[model samples]
Target chain A: MNVRKQFRAGSEFRIADHHPGDKPLSSGDKPADQLRVSGLAEQIAAFQDIFYAEHRRKLLVVLQGMDTSGKDGTVRGVFGRLDPLGVRSVAFKAPSTDEREHDFLWRVHEQVPAMGQLVIFNRSHYEDVLVPVVHGDINEPECERRYRHIREFERMLCETGTVLVKFFLHISRDEQKRRLEARLQEGDKHWKVDLNDLKERRYWDAYQERYERAIRETDTDPAPWYVIPADSKTHRNLAIASVMIDVLQDMKLSYPPPNPEYFKIKVE
Target chain B: MNVRKQFRAGSEFRIADHHPGDKPLSSGDKPADQLRVSGLAEQIAAFQDIFYAEHRRKLLVVLQGMDTSGKDGTVRGVFGRLDPLGVRSVAFKAPSTDEREHDFLWRVHEQVPAMGQLVIFNRSHYEDVLVPVVHGDINEPECERRYRHIREFERMLCETGTVLVKFFLHISRDEQKRRLEARLQEGDKHWKVDLNDLKERRYWDAYQERYERAIRETDTDPAPWYVIPADSKTHRNLAIASVMIDVLQDMKLSYPPPNPEYFKIKVE
Candidate 1:
């Protein structure tokens, strides 16, 4: 199956129905999958060079997932090969006091990709819906209103030449427990092991339900969502890389033609 | 001579006294210098990983130069290896109507690096000094006042844990003209060629004078300026990268110590 179509969320999609451990895009060999990921990274870099030089379109990749679902790993493994000049990765932590002074989307909007740039949102506006809905900060009607706002905003982005790719890194409860424990066991990884992650794990089922709702509400054809099985880190990277490369390829990106007049000019 | 000391602007520094085409950091071999640049890029990346993990310090790199002095190229070559998650490259263009309404530094203050992140300002608040002075929009008194404002603002940033590195990419007039002509001849590169760049080029001498004054007035120990000879693109990249690596090394960055208790935790 085409990776783009394989993992795309359908109208009736249920987060519970997808197996988080599945490796549909992998070659069934860990080393080979890792090698393939490296190849895809290089190809993505090449495409990014042209995309940047063309200097017309914008690309935004949003990663949303449960705690320990590998958002940071995906950034390093999948998008690490590209030059920093043309790519921006924004990790939205809790909003600052100043950011809270504005609307939820204000900070997100400020960081959107400009012409010929690609921006990856390590976490994104979807947090507005997910966190508020899960915590009962906003009721269903208000949640639905924000969904409409998001849809309108994304539609506007699309009309203005931004290409959107959203991903939900799906990891199972057991997998999360194992990952959390591993972080606890690895002394070197302690900095990343936030106590809040553990506190949030207690609300896992609520998060899952809210994530499903968020994905369903905002997953339009123009800004589709892909749910990647992220239990195995290698498979997670492979799937995201495959989906990203597919999206870039479908854009049919090409460099602008060289100028004939350029050939006549000589550096003095 | 150490690359850092070699390029650091002196109390008696005169921009005209520096040769824009000098390659003090290079091996006198183009390909060898290119390879060294790649090596420096990787080392910078490794240091950045630790810096990001340390999560306590802030880094701000400011690139200021004449038109076509390679601000964008410096970004790509020197900082390309960093994980996009931790680095932000902000290209400040002409102010929008809204930005112009606020104090000049208002927008700039909002974009400073938070703890454990690196931000590159392609052109920065220094523009506030250069453009107005060159165009006679501000009188000498106004320019001097703004310089004082900049110094106080920078001192505050340094005190608040931000380590600032400023680079003035020095390019000769003949080199600028050659670059402009090259851009004009290349149809593919036309998108990057702006009529305004040509117009700004007309203010070359004035801009140079203003730049010198800006650097002189603003160059303090905490936020010292390095005047890079930028005619040779390879040398420019090397010098910038060398100075940057030196700065990071001097920072003595190290990863947080491993947690002993983490090894005692077990997954459920």
Candidate 2:
């Protein structure tokens, strides 16, 4: 039997579902293509130490994943090593009445980082296509318009020196179910689980189809999507952090040489 | 010397530097008004626990202060207790060309939180009055217009269920000097301090005068300013964290009730 067939037929097989285009590098016996742990941690540590004098490029890390894929934990564990001064994290939820009155992208456009800052978006502009398509909140024609808007938006950011990194934490339905049930049994974690999440889980396959289409449609040169296998939480985090550090280190930021005027204490 | 003598001098009193009717809580041996540490820890823990479940009220925390007045440290220390899941941090710096083209508050208004989330502003809307007035970027007439605009902007946020808590980390010039020197001498810290900070220090008295006027003019019933003395870093962090906990506790946030409809199994 192939390695994919070695797992329990019904349970573990479903928990380790692999996407069509996933090409993960191997470590040993385990299919590190689905997850790699140790390599990721070492890469994250090295990036954290190479602090640039000035953050020259703005990085927008957009994380989109189903519940229990460790979005919160990824933020805390992976980015936790970074200097807070350079990082700004924003989680976009449902729009407020005031926000709804404006264009859907108005609020998001405002949160983009200035030069020298890193902004993380937990569930971002893709919602315009994903949610509206799923719920019929927007029509197919309207969704097409949104895809173009997103491409233009990302291109504008890149042209202005913003480096956008988008990630879809790809977890198998079985893994999600296992994690959700675990939350219910864990006393302290009960508050983290919601009935709505379970409802959404029933539509998991449909959502996956939508996600695959969205990735195919909107994965532009500037803001490409990296579909990460998130069944192994540690490996998923290390992968995302490794990518972030690599991009930042490539920027070669240096603090602007102190202006000569800064040295002149004036008599005025 | 009297307990208040530290703030007063021959013919010039530090308190007198304040604008008319701008006297903040007097700063003489008045012990830091702090929230109970254990209570604060508990509140933050509870916030983290229930944070994933959706709620209705959004919160905006504004931290405005002089250089080295504990803005960064307070955020790192106080919010360090809360789960980062529900809280977003925004740090605003000097404006860029696109930002400058719009009205001063245009960029800031876009980044306010959505319902049930908490947003922290490292330096907030008050920068309109603080920075522009000091640099003479706007004349008196323009400055007054901005002050009024800022008040209205904040008022709208309060009306829309955003609990706005603005804190001014008030500290003495001597204390600021001490901290800035420490940053320079500390090996790891040396890179973070910039020469521009020293230039801004020279204009300390003018900025303080501008801040006094802004606070007295705009401190409203809905969103009031808490001018906490920030000479002692530990006390400042404790005080700010306590206030945040107290505010959230007063709001009585809870997880959204489970909806069975949202949990129904779907026929794919």
The residue pairs in collision within model 1 are none
lDDT of 1 at A133: 82
Alpha carbon lDDT of residue B149, candidate 2?
Answer: 64
Q: Chain A TM-scores, all candidates?
A: 0.98, 0.80
lDDT of 1 by residue, A1-268 (tens): 7998999996678987899999887788899999999999999999999999998788999999998999999999999999999999999999996665334665787778877889999999899898878889888987887787677667667755789999999999999999999999999999999999899888899999989988998899999999999999999999999999999999999999999999999999
Error of 1 at A262 (Å): 0.7
TM-score, chain B, model 1, is 0.98
Tell me the TM-score of each prediction against the true structure: 0.52, 0.46
User: Worst ten-residue run, lDDT, model 1 chain A?
Assistant: A97-106
Give a tens-digit lDDT track for model 2, residues B1-268: 2212222122222434433222233333334333344446566767756744655777788999888888888777677566777788899998877676444665787878776677789997688788888998778877776666666666656755678888878888888888889999998998879889999999988998887788877777677776666777655655666666666666776788887887897879
Top lDDT model: 1
Q: Best candidate per TM-score, number? A: 1
